[model samples]
Target: MNATTVLRAVGGLLALSLSQQLAAQEVPPSLAELSLEALSNTKVTSVSKRSELLTDAAASVYVITSEAIRRSGYATLPEALRLAPNLQVARVDARNYAITARGFNSAFENKLLVLIDGRSVYTPLFSGVFWDAQDVILEDIERVEVISGPGGTLWGANAVNGVINIITKAAGATQGVLAAASVNGDQRVGTIRFGGRIGKGRFRAYTKTLTLDDLQRESGAVSLTGMQRSQVGARADWERPDGASTLQGDAYTGALHQQGTADIKIAGANLLARHTVRISGGTELSAQAYWDFTERNQPNAFIEHLNTVEAQAQAATLLGASHRLVVGAGYRHAFDRLQNGVGFGFLPAKLDMHWGNIFVQNEFDLTPEVRLIGGAKLEHNNYTGWEFLPTLRLAWNPTASSLLWSAASRTVRAPSRIDRDFYSPSNPPLVGGERRYNIAGGPNFQSEVAVVAELGYRLNLLSDFTYSATAFYSIYDRLRTLEPNQAGAGSVFLNRASGRTKGVEMWADWRVTPALRMSAGAVAQQVRTRLDPDSRDASGTTGLATGDPSSYWKLRTAYDIALGHSIDLLVRHYGKLTRPAVPAYTTADVNYLWRIYPNLELSLSGTNLFEARHAEYGGAPNRTLSGRAVGMKLLWQPK
Candidate 1:
């Protein structure tokens, strides 16, 4: 069915349901009701592996609250991420995104680590996430904590640049029925969920579907085909006075059209279980395990089937009056089978990979106003035998509403299958009297490494305004490069490049009035690299990685017009890219929401209102242009 037809059907169903639930209900408390001081004190766990106030964390972090998600009118996770100034996000197509922090950004960005409820989502093949395959009910997310620096000491390899932790609300807190539908131009989305009690535990199940129309090229011709996806998920939680446990699972499938080619197909499923308990000496212990399966088929390109299993456990305890310690260990195994296409392939066709790591962190109080944090991790992988990651941090609070912090760390991006086993032309055929492949795997590839230092400050003034600023510098070595082989027949992956990066990130929030809030954020950075004297790279040293913007900024405002009405506006500007030469662009978005009834809401939103169409990434003819879009949504949550 077309997007319009599906949208109309879903809209009609929601309207019919809404009519029966017209009674007024009590509105739940929202983030806007919290004072700036209270918001700055939000609890976060990604930085230290333990709950701590956001203002006390020693990392450059940003939290996207649930209320922010609802006010932004973003239907996808990638879109919602644009709110974080520390991140650089670009849409490559209808289903693909290039996201990163500091530097080194690409559709297959390998330096960032992402988690959904503590489950790693990066594929072992390239140590990168397939954004198209990741999704969740936006309304169910408690908060998204984004840390824009190395977290390898705790998260292990691939956390060289940043980490994103998506935390969801417990089923017990979402006990009700929710149905929502949205239509934007030729795109449509629909979701239905139910939550209730099962014995002493709470359970929730949901189904979501989305369809997007084809995108146009600079010439106004269809460049990338449209796509459709469907997903179903469930979660259950049990809590006791001293501990809690959770079990959740998800299954999804999607299809995308390709001009003059067969449709691309994808499907995946995952199951996870987590438990936490209080132990002796006022200690806390937590454990989790998960299994995941994924399948993908791209006609004339390649097909793959992968299975992964992982388990981890951690404990937090107070060693003495001045010291707090956290220790953790994890293990992961992945098995995959690939069917090579004529264009490219991964050698061996089928392979098994293993990874294991153990980490320990200690927080020592130096005085009433100062503290020291240190941690280290020893990780083992199939390709790179063993790698060590370590970090140190110092934080001081001169006043209750102000903080100063500094940190230094060493991290690495371990070799993936692509770095050591990739090959172009699965089976090379004789061409122009040559039977050799164009690209061959690197037999002696090693992990890329980086040493970084950062300084930051945070302040909350008069309980009405809050601001955070961070400055960082990094030196990188053993970076990836494609060097010509001795035989001069093909190129192989190597680590012969070095570079440095320096940047600043800042953001602030202000309550302009009792009903109005304003926020602003910006980031600026520079990257420089050089190749070894003996290195003969086919592409320039900088070509190995994707292009990056030198700077970007965003501004947002939210206003509550009345008891049940609100409006939000956002504006963002991105710096130009140098490699492929994409021009800079600015976009503006606005949303208005009305709570018709206590349990029912209607919203109207417009995206890219300032421009008719623009390009965010990629070069000329093939680059897709995003046009202005408007959407309407209806949500019903029975209390």
Candidate 2:
């Protein structure tokens, strides 16, 4: 069907839902049963890789529950992340997202790691993520765990910046048919789901799809590069008095056919099983196994296809009433086959790669108010042989309403397939040789490692207010860089330099009443890199220095209206970037949502709300990295 037809149909459904809500508003729920204190004290898991009360956790963490998602009216995962503090969200074009935590934001941001129910989503080809290819039914998500800072001791590679864990609800929580659709300026999204109980377990399945309008050019002209995506997922759970276990999986099959541009199609899947056992010794043992795969193809791009596979197993046990121990290992094997074409070189041979790691951690409670945590991980990979990572943490609970914490950790980021073994053509013809010379990949590149120290405090200020603040300093060694070689236009990846990154994050929340809430967050960071004593900058200089402004802030306000209704407003501001070639500019966004009914909702959101002419990063004169985009959506669930 055409876009217009689909939109009209969705509009009709939304009208009916709104009418139903208006008819039911006469009888609102009692105010005594709901209050603000209860919402701010909710528990979360992303901070420690385990569940804990938000007020009691040591690290900085944020929780956006299912209700929050519904009330915000966001149509996609990336859209929702804009509400988070310390997060940098930017659109680099028609099909790229520049998202990061603290700093180092880019289209293929490598500092941060994202997961859906314990499943890692990083790609082996670029050592980054393709946000456009990742989608989920927002309604099915129980909560989003956002942690700022290193999660290496627990999460492994690419956890240098932070971790975003998208946790979905179990089958039992959603027990009926649900259908939702949304429309706005240039994007449309729809979702459907069903849930029920089986013989011995509960099972639920869902599908989400989206079609985005073409991106706008600097002249306000559309790029004719729009894309479409679809995703399907399911979850099952079993619980008897004896214990509880759960199994979950998802499959994403979609085509990114851009008009008049190179089209790429991808298919992927993820599966996981978790088991928890309570022992007579008062210790709990838990284990989980997970795997993810992705296959992609871009007919026009020289680098034609990439297939990746990742699998992992982890186990944890409580050693005593005050000590918790964890140990587990896993492996990742990726195979890449490429074809040569314009601006690209052929892969003389296919590449086979493997990554393995094992880790352990101990949490000790020294006193009723003080606790300590320590851990380490050993990793082996094709490029880097044996490597070790260690960490230590100290936490103090002054009262039931506040916590102070500090941590020290060392971790590494291994090379990708392209970094260790791949070839490419040169851009802007080299000083010598043919118009293009293949870039060289090395098998001797050392892993990127860093030592990070952090301190933070969390406080429950008043009956309806909460706040968290954190500061960190990191020293990086063995950074990878490329230099022109004698092999015509050839460049190699090697351990070339050292750098330092320091930053602070602060967030505050205030509940004006049971129906009104407000939140604000901000980040200030700086990074500086210098060429090694024996190394040379791209310009042949002995030293070159640079850093991005890395400063940004966000504000949000929400109200829960009568009769199961709510509305939210959000505004985000990005600071002017000033380093590594300044194309700096600031921008803002506005978003709103309305819960038309308990089982239905509608949302309207837009980025670059003022159509600000700004550049978050990159320095291409013709770069259309800044603009405005608006969208809407509808969600429905029948009891």
Candidate 3:
């Protein structure tokens, strides 16, 4: 649909809602519920590694609150991420997803960094996340902070494009038993959780399971089989006058079915501990540690057993009346054991990787209304020895409800196993009297780098309206590419590509009434790439890193129909893809909830209501089509 049509639809919906609300006699919504003013004042830590009001944050950040998640009726993390306008999320299969920010979107997108409670989840093999393997109890999540800019200055390497931080609620906040279940034609999910007290501490334990049916291709043929997963986890928190501590752990196992092949199996477990103490001179010291293990076996593909251990510590304090400083250091180690498959594999099979970084950031209060922030990180990795990331930001608060900010930063995506050690044909054989492989990793592969600049503005009108906008431009160098060997052996990975990306992200929230709210978000971006003059890259790797739409927009509305009834509607439009030639499409989703009792609720949700089936990613007959989905959920929470 064109922009005009979308605008008309949104206007019609708004007029209808206003008319209905005007005729109703129900009371206003409770103040305890989320409000536009509350949303603007939401505390976000991803922007500067310190808690601050969302509107005051200089970075292009969006916060997906718990209330939004509960109302959307999304069952998976990737689906929830769609609420962020700056992000591009595509479902690849029954279990896999491709998600990124700005541009350079792909299944193996390496520039975006993701963290769950301060623990990184990207795999060393590709410097990307396995969306299928990463799961969390949606009900336990507090908020998801998404920043659509380089965060490497504080987050370390691989944060070249953006960062997503998934933060969960404290144990004490969930002090009762909660159970939820949802089922649709293609999927089913169930979860049960209980929280109580343990000697001066609060504890919670939960278990969850999900099953999905097979999906069909554009030709109505089954493309991929179903998948299932089961998980159990627990969290405990202790709080004192001066300090707090937390411990959490989770374990999961699952399998994905494949046609004419053995099922792919996956299992993993993680444990994390964190502590924070308020020290003298208003200084706060915090420390975190985590151990993660993952195993995946794809018959005829590959088998991997990976273990990772990481530790980090940071201190935040005021150096003087005008400066706030933060200093930290981190170390991570990974042991990756790979069982080569007949088709391709990482050479040497087993390897050990280490990473370490130290960062320092300071915010100078140049004046009461102005601030300057500067930070840098020195990171060392096994593949790319040492890299530097730095950022400078300036923020000016012209008024109590208006903020203008600008930033410049340098970030990098360090080489992964795929770029340094991968080899096609685990055992190469003689081809035309020459032993050759189709592809080989490059020993000289270097880190991909990006220098980015951003400008943003935020405005709030009273307690009823808020808006945010950010524009960014990035210059990239040493991008990954595939170069043919001089000896005609095969193509090898190399740094032979460069590119530039520019984009704008915008979002707004309007409280039409005390019981009605509306939000709109949109993104427009362009990516341009070129091959180095002396490099001969035959694989068209320049375009391989990006598969994105020129523009996309979404409009959402939430209405409280009655004292215990609410309804939410969302409309999204995506532009066409040039390289893959995917047609443009518009979709609508709706959800309705009824609170039967103070502690019990039921909801019905429908997705892709405007289409029978559509493809969001991939090409041709091989791509899976997402069909219309309708589901009902029951949630119970005991006081």
Best by TM-score: 1
Give the lDDT of residue 459 in candidate 3.
97
Ten residues in sequence with the least summed lDDT for candidate 3: 24-33
lDDT of 1 by residue, 1-639 (tens): 999999999989866654544433455554456678778778999999988899889999999998899988888888899888788998876777889999888777899999999999998778999887899999999999999999999999999999999999999988899999999875788999999999899999999998878888887779666789999999999999889999999999999878789889999999999999987776899999999999999999889999999999999998878889999999999998999999999998999999999999999999989999999999999998999999999999999889999999999999998999898978898767865778887889999999999999999897699999999999999998889877558888999888888999999999988788999999999877788787888675456353788899999999888766789998999898876668999999898987766778888999988889888877886888888999999999977
**What does candidate 1 score on TM?**
0.95
How big is the positional error of residue 543 in model 1, measured in Å on the Cα after superposition? 2.9
The residue pairs that clash in candidate 1, if any, are none
Better of 2 and 3 by TM-score: 3
lDDT, candidate 2, 1-639, per-residue tens: 999999999989977977786786643342222454675667876655555678776776777777667666677888777767867877666556778786666666676889888777787665678887787888788888888788777787778778888888877888889998887556788888899988888888988888876665655555555678888888888876555688887887666655466667777777788776666654455667766666676665544345445555555566768877767777767665666555554345466767788888778899999999888888777767777878898999988778999999887777776666555652336565554455666557777787889999988865777888999998888876666654455566666788888989999888777677788998888877766776543642112223346677878877666544555667676666544244445445444555566665566666666554555555445445455666676667765
List ranges where model 3 is wrong by over 4 Å. 1-33, 430-435
Q: CA lDDT, every prediction?
A: 0.89, 0.71, 0.88
RMSD of each: 4.0, 4.8, 6.7
Instruction: Evaluate model 1: give its lDDT.
Output: 0.89
By TM-score, how accurate is candidate 2? 0.88
Q: How accurate is candidate 2 locally (lDDT)?
A: 0.71
Clash number for each model: 0, 3, 0
Model 3 Cα lDDT, one tens digit per residue, 46-146:
88887779988999999888888888888888988988878888777777787999888877888899999999999989999988788888888999999
